[model samples]
Each structure stands twice: as structure tokens, then as C-alpha cells.
Target: MGPGAGEVSWRHWICDARDGRLICPIDIPSFSWDMGIGDFGFSTTDKGAGKIDESGLTLPWAAIPASTPDERSAMLDSQRRAIVTTWAASDDPEDKGTPLFWGKITGRDDTWLDTSFGLESPMAILSSRYAVRDGAFKDGHSSDSIAFTGMSYRGICSELGRIATDGKQGGELPFDWTYTGERGSHDRTDYQAWNVQNLAVDQLLTNIANCQGGPDIAFRPYWADEQHIRVRFLAGSDADVYLDMDHSPVCLSSFPDGGSLEDIHVSYQDGYHRWYATGAGTDQGTLTCYVESMAPITQSMDPPVLREAVYGDTDTDNLDLLRRHVGGVAQNNSGKLMQITGSIDFGDTDQFGVPLHPLGSMWPGESVTLSIAGFPTLPDGDYGLRLMEMSGDQGSKADLKFDVLEAPFQ
Candidate 1:
């Protein structure tokens, strides 16, 4: 079964990020969210390739009531000290809402016809802190590199996440997270080490996740109550690839004759046969690892095409970590760069007037099936929902623009 079709309404609130307390409720006439699950690049040199999800919306000055000059000024501040909470509920009489977006304000547009603001996911907040050496605050060398030895990549990400949201730097963010899924072979090896120095928390996390055996990363927002908004950070080995047929099957098909589909694009990225990566240290002591693709095509080549690239991070001295990082690039890029993109109506209905797929039907990291008959070359079966953008206004259905990946079978 696919997502339920229905009508939904929205509500917006202005809130404090330090305490998740709602400051006031404002009617948001329209809004849009460009949510991303993970890195979309194929190169290893993409250092700051971490996903920085974002949203944009306009607010009229008259949306809120302010009795004093100070009150009005505080409500319009665009320094990201405050956050916006978006909620959606079925048009049912009960109106049980589901928190949709919780992002920190990063920019404003008072110069526009209506005051508009740009917002970013918690990653923007996480980018505020530098990955200082653990316990560097007590030591005089606060800028020295920090190292994690014998811990899994998941452990490293969790520790960094905690440090970013922990109140040590100042007040903590209104966020929480958990690490779920299988542990990799590098989870607890004494000889392995991961190091960081003076890098933003978000960048460092992305570097780790993009490594050979790194976990998939994603963020979600939740409404604890009418007065609070909470954000969650999710990371795991198989976090985004799981398939639950009962609830996860989202069937989207466009017949060759006619359908509401307006546009579609299919693109592919080149893959590399040989991969190499460098880690921390320099001179003769600098650590490095290399791997070649096992893909049949690469093996069948007469000269074995030497497509080489350097990917992953340079903060680790662990040879195992470096090997996995480069190997992952080869594994993922071995002729499997097919990506599909299109726009779909979240409120479309069948001849019987039944909703086809409603808003909130799918999310980043989930899988959806597309049977696009017009494109005969398009692969069949499920594809990973890499990114999804939902845009709409107060009383209408949303339009979703999505990017999906079809992994090449080994």
C-alpha cells in the first residue's frame, strides 16, 4: 500500500531554540522545505559535502500582534537565535497535528514586498562549534587536534553530535539524537584512530559519514507540545535502505498516454575503478589506502581502466579507516550513479476522487517505486529517496520535487 491521500492544514509558531519554548503563533501563508538525507557527490575531495538542509518562507509584519516597540523588534530578529516550527494536520475535525519543519532562522528579507526569512536545519547550528581536541578547554592548547581511537564510526558521530548540542560552549540546542543500526568492523579496534582539529562539527560529521563504511545521516523535527519544538539527528549503517513493504511502499506511476506529470530528468555519474585516500600526518609518516573496483566491467577491461580518485577525510591516521573510506567510494561509484528527479502532486486524486498520495506521504531516506512508462530505459523497482522538497501554501496541496538513486546491483 502507498501513502494515504487526504487534505491537510498547517500552523506555524515562533520559538526559542535554547529552551524549545514557543514565543508566539503566526499564520504562515506559504512555506517550502528542501530536505536532504546525505551527501550527493561522488568525489572524495568534497570535504564540506555535508548536507545542510534548508527552508524558506515569507511572513507579513501584520501576522503577529506586538503591543510595544521592543516586542516587535524581538519578533523580527533574524540572527537565528529563534526558530520556526511548522505543523500539519489532516482536515479532520480533530486536527491532530504533526510537526513538519523545525529550522533556525539564518537570513531575512525585509527588503522584499513581504518580510521573508531563510532557515537551515540543525546542521547550521552544529556548524557553530569547532571540533576541538577533547578536554582542550582545560588544556592551554585548545586548538590542538582531537583523536578517537578504538571506537566505531557511529561512536565518533554520536560523540561529535553530543558535543555540538551540549551546553558546554553556551546553552544547548533544542535537539536530541540517537545512533541506531549495525556496527562496522572498525567499531572497536585498538590500532585504529580518527582525529579532528579546528573543523566545524557538521563538516567533520559529513567527512566521517562519507567514508567507505560510514553510516547514513538524517534529521527530523517533532513537536513535543504546543509550547515546544524538538529536532532529532539519526545515523546508522542501514538507516536509509531498509524496506518495509506494508507502510513504505509508495507507488508513483505515469502512463505513456497521459498523466499529471509535468517534467522528469534522468542523469548518471561516472564511476572509478581505482580509489585512493590520504589521512592525517605528513612526510613519510602520512597514512594512505587504496582499492580497486570488483565490478565485472572493470575486471573485463583489457587494460583495466585506471580511473583513480582521492576521497574521504585527512583527519585519520588509521590505515583501516582510510581503506574503508576509499573502498566505499569505489563500491558506491562502480557504475551505479543513476539518479531520477521529478515533481509530483501530493493532492492528486483518481477518477473516484480518492487521494493518490497526500502531503507527508514520504520522507528523505525512504524508498519509493516509480514505474515511468514514458522512459523505457528507466530502471524498474525501488529507488532510495535521496532528497525531497515540499512546497505549498495554507489551504492547498503540496508539490514534491524529489531526487532518488537507483543503486547498481553487484
Candidate 2:
């Protein structure tokens, strides 16, 4: 029997616009699915702003046999309108069965009888909120006029909730979401203002992340189905899973075996040691602040180390506050950095060998502790690593790339 309507398998389905239900597409010979989270890092020159990379999915269906040209045309049309609410669930019964990805069809290409569908994670929805007004006007306005002025991370999410549910933007948000209320315990007395006149929601969130100090914070959003979305605020090194070589589900005997860490890169240039800040003011007399890394300068490095500056506009002129700002920047750039990219086959079962969520089923920003035998550089300890990007087809195999979180100098 054909798959029933609203049935979900390790396959793609188009949501019926009329009734908002998932319906399997016709003539699917073969299909592949891949999805993952994006890599986020600090930008050296952008005033410590966190740089968020994009995450998405690529699904391609093999030669679908269409008996008639009219049938082919209808299929293409249906796919187009249906891209807005594309959803997928793994065939693995033990898999969370959550919508692995909720995305809009980004592209569609047809050749004879086969069609390919491109999908991106819901992050696209967040990025869609961009600066709508000019920065100059926003800079001129005081904090009192901004909606989220001096709001905590929780408060910020509440404001975002307002935006998503108000219906002023037309269609209701496809998924329901809530703030997890996770934030650092830093003094929030330093009032920060955002010009809501034209700023997008994502831009404001990015600014908040970059400027806040203490534990690094992140926002992650995921969907289980068309009607539910969960947003979580994660603090530094908050790992979702801990994988050990002997106890973990990883298949030690498989091809590509466990995983490998490589591409070690390190640098300590003048750019990494200096910080500059331009305070709030008109062109004529704005104060410019400079700070240096606490790490003692090494005389051996050529081109004598120079200073880096972070510029911003705020009401505070207190030198202590300025020092605090620059200090945060210096600490952010102090550590030697490295990255590991490889695939680990989680043996098809849990530690007890019972079949469960396929090995390698993970998300971006999720942390994992590795206890592999090789690689002396990465000792068998509880060092936290965040998954930056992951990809794999449906089954027991998967690949992941991640960044090692090195502790900043205290």
C-alpha cells in the first residue's frame, strides 16, 4: 500500500497548503537527507561580535517516473507551493521522530523525470529579521525609545515572542517557541540601547551576544513538527552528550573508525593583543578608547605588536567601564585555537547494544566529550567540543565538524 497521507518516513513530503498536512510526493525512486547546525565564532575587528554561519539541508530525489508530461508539470507546481512547509522524519523508529528539519524549498531543478529540493534550517527565519532602519538615526535615539532597552536575555526573548505572535507580519509563525531563560550572572546595570526603528530581530540578538560578558551565550531553535518550535539559550560549554570510546555507541571497528582531529592553527599577532573603542558622540569630539591584552608581550615577534580598538557609542564615560569592555575583548582573543573535523560511526546500538537513536545523530552547538585512543594532542579528558556542522544520509553513518573550546586566560 502507498504511504498514507501525513505519514513520515526517511523521506521528504510537501505540506498541503489547503489543510496544512504533510503528503508524500509521487514517483520517488530514491532520496537522500542531510542537515546540521552552523559554526559560530568571534570576529576580530567587529567589536567582538559573534559571527554565525548558516546551517541548512540538501535533499535530492532520484529519477521519479512520470507517465505523462502533464503529470510532470503538476508535480513541479505542487512542489513549488509546498516548499514553504517542507518536513522530514527519519525512518529509524528509535530516532526522536521529530521533524529533523523545518525549511522552505530554496530551489527546485527538474531533469526529465527527477527533481531536486534544496532546504535550509529555520535559522533563515531568524536571519530574515535585518536592520530595516538606518544606523545613523538609531545611534541618535536614546535608550528610552527602544523596546528591548536594558532587557535581560529572558526579556529579549519575550520581546521576540511578541514579534512572532503579533500577526502584524501577516501569516502566523509556523512553530510555537519559548525562551529557556538561560543567561550569565553578570551585572546588567550597563544600559544598552537598540534602535528598533529598522533593526531586524537577528541583528539585535547578535549584538546582545557579542556585548554580554561572563559565560558565552547562544540561542538555538529547533522544531519537532509544524506546530512546535523550541528555542534554547545555552551558556558556555553546555554539552548535550558525553561520548566515551569504550562506553559510547561509536563503532570502533568501522571504516573511518572513531574520529580524528587535525588542522591545528595558532597565531599571536598585534591584532590579537589590542582593542579600541570609540564612545558615543558627534563627529567632532567622540572619545576613542584603547586597551591591550594582559598577556605579556614577547620581544621575539617581529613588527612590534600594535593595538586593536573596539568602537561604540554609549552614555558611560567612566574609565573603569571602558577598561572592562576592552578587558573582555582581550580575554576573548587570548587562547590558542584549533578545530577537529571527522566522522565517527556510533555502533548501531546504545552502550547496551540496544538499537536507539542512530549513532552520529546530533545537532550544532551540542557538546560532546571524546575518549578516542589515538591523538595525543587531544588527551582523554572532558574537554568540551561544539558541533559546528554535521551531515549524513539516513542510516547508521554520519560525519561532523567541530570547534574545541579553549578556556580564556583568567
Q: Which is the leading candidate under lDDT?
A: 1
Instruction: Tell me the tens digit of each residue's lDDT in model 2 across 286-404.
Output: 66677666354553343334445565635435565555655656675644445556654333345664443332245554555544444444444444565656554333344666654
Residue 136 of candidate 2: its Cα lDDT? 23
The most accurate candidate by TM-score is 1
C-alpha TM-score for every candidate = 0.74, 0.58
**Overall local distance difference test of candidate 1:** 0.57
lDDT of 1 by residue, 67-170 (tens): 55577667756653465544343556345366656766656666423556566567776777665534555533333444455566666776667755673656
